[model samples]
Every structure is written in C-alpha cells, then in structure tokens.
Target: MSDTTQPPFSVLFVDDEEISRNHFARAIRADYRVHVAQGADEAIDVLARHGAEIAVLVTDFRMPGRDGDDLLRQVAHEYPQIVRILVTAYADKDMLLQTVNTGDVFRILEKPLRADKVREALQLAIARYAERETRQQRLLAMSETLGFLAHELNTPLAAISLFARSVENDVAADYDPERQKDIGAAARAMLNNAQFCLTLLSSFWATVHKSGGQQSVAEAGGREVRATRLIASLLDTYPFAGAQRDWIEVDVQGDFVVRTMPNCVALVLSSLLSNALRALADVDAPSLRLEVVDGSEPEIRMRDNGGGIAPEIRARLLQDPVTTHAGNGGHGMGMIFCNRIMQSFGGRLGIESTPGEGTTVTMSFPGPRNRL
Candidate 1:
C-alpha cells in the first residue's frame, strides 16, 4: 500500500515500447511518482526539466537511437546523485561489468521484470541517496562551526596583540637597559604569536565564507605575490623564542612572483616553523635556513639542523596524520592539513630528513600558468 501522506519521491523510466512503459508505471506508481519516456532523447529532455525532483533512473538497455549505455553514461556525468538502474532482456556480461565498475549503474535488472525486485532496488537506492545527503550536511555543519569559532577568537587575539604592542612602546626609560631589553623581547614575542593566530583565524573565516561551508579548491582565488617579500614577512612575524631568531638565515637565489593564496601559504609556513622549532629545542647552536629557489617550478625550502625524523615516521607524515610529539597534545593532523592546502593550490609539499642530522621541508608551487 502506498503512503499518500506526502508526495512520493520521483522515478524516471525510459523504454521504447509503449506497453512496457505503461505496465511499469502502473505497477509502481502507487509507491513512487513515475515519469516515463519513449527513448533516450526523451529521457534526457525529461531529466532537464525535472532532474532535481527525480531520485532514480530506470532505463531499458535496448532502445532506438542512443542506447541505454550511452544515456546512462551521460546521466552519470550530469546527475551523479541520481541512482541509475539498467533494465534489459538480453544482458551483455562485459557491458554490465564495465558500467558497474564505472559507477554508472547502481543495479542491473534482468527483464521479465519482477515487481517485488524492482521495488526492493528502488528502496535501497533511496536509502543510499539519503545517506549521502546526511553525510554532506554533517560536513557543512562542521565547517560552519569551525568558522564561527575562528571568527569569535579574532576579537580577543586582536586585543592581546594591541596591548602587547602598547606595552612594548610605553616602557619607561628609568628601568635598567638590560631589564628593559628583556621586557621588550617578552612583549614582542607575545605580539608576534597573537598576530600569527589572528592571521590564521582570518584566513579560515574567509575560506569558509567564500565556499559557503562546502568543499572546493578554486573558489578561493590566488594572486601574484613577490617571493622575497613573502619570505621576509614570515621571518619578521613568526614568534621566535629567545635568541632563536638569531639562529636562522635567509638566502634567495632569484626574486620571482608566485600566484597563490598568501594566507594559505602562511598557514603552511606556520606549521612547518612550529615543527622545526620543536625539533631544535635540545640541539646545540641550532641553524634554520629559508632559501627561495626561482625557476620554472618555484620553491621555498626550509632546512633545519635539529634532531631529524626517523625513516619510519617520515614515510607516513604527509599521507596520514602521524605525529612523533603525541605526548605534547599533537593530534598529527598538521602535516596532513598542510599537504591538502598545498595540493589545492596546484602545488606540492615534500620532506627529507636523516636522524641526528636535520630535516629539510620543500614547498613547490606551480608556475604562473598553472595557478589555481
């Protein structure tokens, strides 16, 4: 018995024979709202008009002019969410296997169609559609929540940064020179960390708003930025604790322009910088170098002389969220996130390390023509 409390979800049926279309509709119209087409062309036209309303497509494999396989391929590309089912009296095993492997058809119904079997397939297809919709909604909700938290955090971070700057500037001349220097350094560190946090939050907020909490790469556009200037900015703003800033060197082979999202680049640099700093914590006379190599494929390499990563851990660093500093609240997602961002920019992130020697992280970006 059809539940008539609400409008039934729609199904599109395509068959060349008039009797087959009529019989199929009559058998299932009580449970589903049916739309029938005489051939593949008519089916495409019907889809153009009611694609959003239709949840499933049931097309006979044999039809005049554009057969079911061709129609299924077109529909699969155009309307991926719609579940497709192929109905055929003469089922070609090779063709069936190919369509199934390519994910064009959810099910293949052998004809002399059983009403119970058809109904069962429709039920399962609808369930699968519902599951995809639910998963999409959850991801959107998570993105929105993260954006909201980032937005809310911006205020306090900005306030802290402003206060730190003020303290650094308003220090009294009556204090001893050495004492004043220590106080100023502390204030500067606080200010730098606060500013870095603000930068990350702002970028995240913009990304979420631009994509409307959806998954996309090209929605956030890129712009041309000078490589030397970007490296200088990162070095100036990065929160280097006590004498750590003195341990670093910058070497630019040539100046070039890179087209990418600067905020995203900054976020990646922050993650790499944090990791490098932690690794250098116990090393003597630590050295970190930022070298920009300009060519057809532009790159910024960060080389640090620190306790290098083990081979086993380095193997899965980018592929999985695997971290060595789990005891320090590391969830191991930093490298994974960085890798994803680099890929979205049509770029790549690579790492090389030798234990007891050092680690060098490379960020390679596409040339001007390949920018995303």
Candidate 2:
C-alpha cells in the first residue's frame, strides 16, 4: 500500500453506555477509523473478526458484561500488538495501579472523557503501533534472507556430493596405490566441503524458523556430549583425507563432559577443524591436536602446526564473510558461525596465533554443574 493512500489507523472503543461510546467515537472519527462495542462480549466479537485491521483499543472500565480492565487484560494477552487505553470513570487508584502492572493499560484517562485527551491517546497509540510493525517487518526480512541463502547453496552442494562419491568409488578402483590415495584424498575433500555446506544450511534454517515469541533458536539441548564422543562422531560422519587425518589428534581428560546441544557443539567443532585443516594445506609438517582439560571449567584446545594466520587477516577472518579464494580453499563463514554458537551457549571461543608458527583455537564451556 502506498503510504499516502493508506487508511487511517483503526481504533475500537468499548463502553457499557451507548452515550459514552458514541461520544468517544465522534471525538476521534476524523483522525481514526473507529468502531464501538456496547460490552466486553461485543468488543471480543469485533476483535475476533477484525483484529488484524484494528491498531488501537479504547475501553471503559465500568461495563456490565465485561469491565474495561477485564477487556484490556484479554487484549494484552491475545492481541498485544494492539495498543490498549482504558477510558473509564471508575479510576480506583489501586485498580489503575494493578492494571498498569499487569501490562493492560498503555494510558488511563479519567471518565469525564475530554475530546483532547481521547485524541492524544489515539495519537500515541498509532505511533507505538507503527514502531512495533516496523521492527516485526525487519525481523521477517532477515529471516527470509537467511532462508534464501540456504536454498541457493543446496543445489550445487548436492551435485558435488553425488559426483564425489562416484569418483571415490570408480577412480579408486582403477588406480595404483599411490595415485589411488591421491584421488581418494581429493574426492574426500570435496565431499567434506559439501557436507559442511549442507549442515550449515540446516542450522541456519532451524534458527530462522523457531516459534512462540522466541526470537531465535539456541544451541540444541537435552543431551550430554563428551569431547571424545563428538570427535569420533565427526570423523565417522565427514570424509577427511589421510593427510588431513594424520595432521590432527584429539585427547580428552578422563570423564570430561559438557552440557550443551550436541548438534550445535558438533557443528562448531567441525567448522573449527575444517578451518584448521584448510590452513595446513601448504605446511612443511602439518599437525593439529585437540586436548581437553577438566578443571573449574571444561576447556578444549585445538592447536595446529600449519603456517599461522597473518596478523592483518587474523582479525578479519574471525568476523563474518571470510574470503581467501586466492589461497587453498578458505571461507571464514564457518568460524563466524561457530563464534555465534559459542556465545549462544554461554561459552567463549578464543584464538591465538603467531606468524610462521601455528594457530590454536580454544572453546571453553561450563563444566559439570556450571563450574567457573
């Protein structure tokens, strides 16, 4: 709808007395689209039928069927998007105070309703309603954007995965040991990248589609995940070449465990591991090790012998949209997403690197019983 052509904001006035209802309706008719209800039941019927079009609710406190306070409470719970104003003569100080505390009344006016006071309430209601609509629309737009990115990445990734599996089986059978190993390694790398893309898509989709006033999805919950179990699962699920596997090692202190959403933690760990392996592509002696320590808090240390990140690139890569297309395949989106995951779980992701030496990524989370 064009801004200039949009209809006046709709307002619903509920009062027990017909005279009061008509008086308030006539006062704001010029500035608002107004509807009047004789009692609470009638007002609910109007709300049920025209809730989307109604932006403001003006109800009187003294009604035979449903009092103004009762009506406003219903609106607050059921249609909070509609700003509520109580227009009533029975402004008992305690009652008014209770209404405000319960979030029922945006504004309360004494019963000798003046045209000016009613109009002012409507004006403020319209402004607040507009602000809420803008925020909701922005959230919806961002959610759609994330969904679109996930949909776009799915097609190419699926094709690559299919082709990689065919090559891994067919090409490995035809080559000698040395050449076969190389071909297998290349195929596994392609497959791993494809799997990473797929998992990321799933996570983004889940986060965008959460329900019930929940703004976003937190890390998955309901499972206790140990570092060793997580590492073993990732190794079995995603393909990694001999060189990649040889350069990486994982060790956990006895009985170390973290309370977290298993899948989210796994996704973060996989992303970090993938980034470390990508960094090691040209190292003289590539090696990555993960050691878990159980103390006041559970800590995981991932260190690599690969050429460490450059000082200039280190900070940038930690942020979103990391691009290193000129070098071996490197996209910093993984680490950026991992950082968000850690923060969501009340944990921290730490990075340390020295030029020409190596990089270490540490993830710290609550140990058993929320220790340190």
Candidate 3:
C-alpha cells in the first residue's frame, strides 16, 4: 500500500500544530504533492485558491474555530470530489462517533501516525476517488454512445413512420369492409412495429440527451409517487395489462407513495412489467402480484404465478441476456434496462424462480427519509 505508484495528486494536510503538520507533510514528501494548512480558515483559503488540484484533504480531528469534523463537513459540502480523512491526536469517543456518523470522513488515522500508515491511507483515498471518477467517466461515455445511436435511428424512423401513416390513410379512404380490413391489419401491424422501434430510439435518445445535458444533474428533493397510480395510468395503454391484470384484481390503488423521479421509475417498471407479461404469455392462470410493504425501505415485489423460467435460464436471467421468447425478438434488453435503472436509483433487482412453479421479481429502495 505505497503511494509511489500512483500518479501525482495534490493533498491538503490541515492541523493547528505547525510541528505535526510539517511532520506529516515530510512523510509524504517523497510521493504526493502536499499543501499544509494551519487551520480551517487557511484550509478554506487554500481550497478556494486551488480546489481543482486538491485530490485529498487530510485534516486533524481537533482544531481551533472549526474542528476536524467541521472542516470535513465543509469539504463534503464544497468539494465532494476531494476525499476527506480525519487524522487527529484527540481521538476521543465523541470525535470518533461524529466522524463516522457524518459519513464524510474516508478514514480516521490516530495520533503518532507513521509514514507507512499515512501513505497507505492516502493510497486508499486516492484509489476510492479514482474509482468514483471512473464511474462518472463511464457514465458520460455511455451518454455519448446513446446520443450517437439516437442520431442513427432518426434517419430510418423518419421514413418508416411517415410512410406508415400514409398507407393507413389510403386504406381508410378507398377500401371496402373486407378489403379495408386486410389492408388495415397489415398497416396496423407495420405501424406497431415502427412505433416500437421509435419508442426504443426515443428512449435511448432521451436517456443520452438527458445525460449529456445539465438537467440530469442529481437533484435534492422529494415527491409523492404512488406505485398503484403508475400502474393504473398504464393499464389502459400498457400492452400486457389486459392479459396479466385480468386474473388478479389490482386493489392497491394508493397504498404506498415514494419520493423519486417518476420518469426513471417508470422506465424501470415498464421494462420489468413488460418482461413479466412476455414470460407468462402461454402459461396457465397467469397472475401478477404487486405489493408495497412498509419497512426500512419501500420494498415492491412484482411476481407472476406463471410457469417459472427453466433452471438453466433462471441462473442467467438477469445476469446475462438469453433468447427465451422468439416471437417478440427478445434480446433481454428489457431486463438489462430494468436492472440498470434499479441500480442507478440506489436500489436492487432480485429474482426468484422455480423451474415448474413461478417467477418473482423484487425491487427495493430507501424509504422516504422516515419509515412509512
């Protein structure tokens, strides 16, 4: 756990004591590019002046005016990208607990910090920072890919969609009942296929465009959203609502509400619900159960009482894309989309299936600040 291998990163060592600050600074002089700050005010000044270069904030837990915890809090608020570590001589019970509870401090190094220990902590901090930065970069790259894909889809969709409307209009005005029925059927089929394609294209487009734009920046707020309401709204237009909801009467209308982005949630549910419908296409007594239970978080389960996925397919169902249904051109994209959406929302997608019994999918997210 040496910092010698890492690319040079700027680190801020904050402490009221000049001797301690110099000692720690000298310890890492061989590796990291260090900047010493005597107090919180000086640290703030240094950060304001050189925020972009600072990668790690190593501060003592006890300091004048603003203690280590307070300094970390400010850093957390001002520069969340800069990793904060509490290195203090006064490792009292209160300080230790507060540092842990704030959730801002990356690691707590006790007094009499050795050069090796300091080096190791800085390495860990740098690695963690790099990992998060990588995720952000990958996310950005995915956004770019989606934007390029959307541009590609626009050309073909424009031609197909416009032509489908023209064909439908012609059939309506000229054909007789029998002749019109055949023509209408073909037109409708083509229109549906084209619409599906457009939907996918637009979805990708929206996802990418939003990612690229500033609108998708993580916002801090809360909204009331009912799972049942989302379902009810889609029941009329959702393709599988009739087949799946008919047997099982959806009774939970407004039982639970969550604070989340409706569009992101809809994307998750639509993908999952659509897949469930497809999976139960030929099964007897096809039924779906959606229940929102009160707990540490909003746990919503969508389970279908249909023939479960085969053992071979069950293992790879969510992890890998497998062609189970051929008629609808199932590429397993729907499930993948659902899983990714869940993960993005700090939730998880889980599945339970018995070869001959049924399949159940569960989604869980943190409850609204407090338990409902």
Best by TM-score: 3
TM-score of 3: 0.52
Candidate 2 lDDT by residue in tens digits, 113-203: 9898777878888998977775564354344345434533544376466657766676748667776666666676576657667665665
Pairs that collide in candidate 1 are none
> Which number leads on lDDT?
1
State the local distance difference test value for candidate 3.
Answer: 0.67
**Candidate 3 clash total?**
0
What lDDT does candidate 2 reach at residue 291? 86
Better of 1 and 3 by lDDT: 1
Q: Which parts of model 1 have CA positions greater than 4 angstroms off?
A: 1-195, 203-223
How far off is model 3, as Cα RMSD? 12.5
Clashing pairs in 2: 220-261
Q: Across residues 1-372, which tens digit of lDDT does each residue of candidate 3 receive?
A: 355665468899998888998898788977778899999989999999989888999988777788877788888999989998887665375658867778478888888788889999999999988767656644643553444344334433664566577666766686567766666665655664465455545545554554342233222223345666656654544433234568544535235665433345555665666667776777777777776665666666777877777878767766776646645545554455556655654566888888667788887775666321
Model 1's C-alpha root-mean-square deviation from the true structure amounts to 14.8
Better of 1 and 3 by TM-score: 3
Query: Candidates sorted by TM-score, descending order?
Result: 3, 1, 2
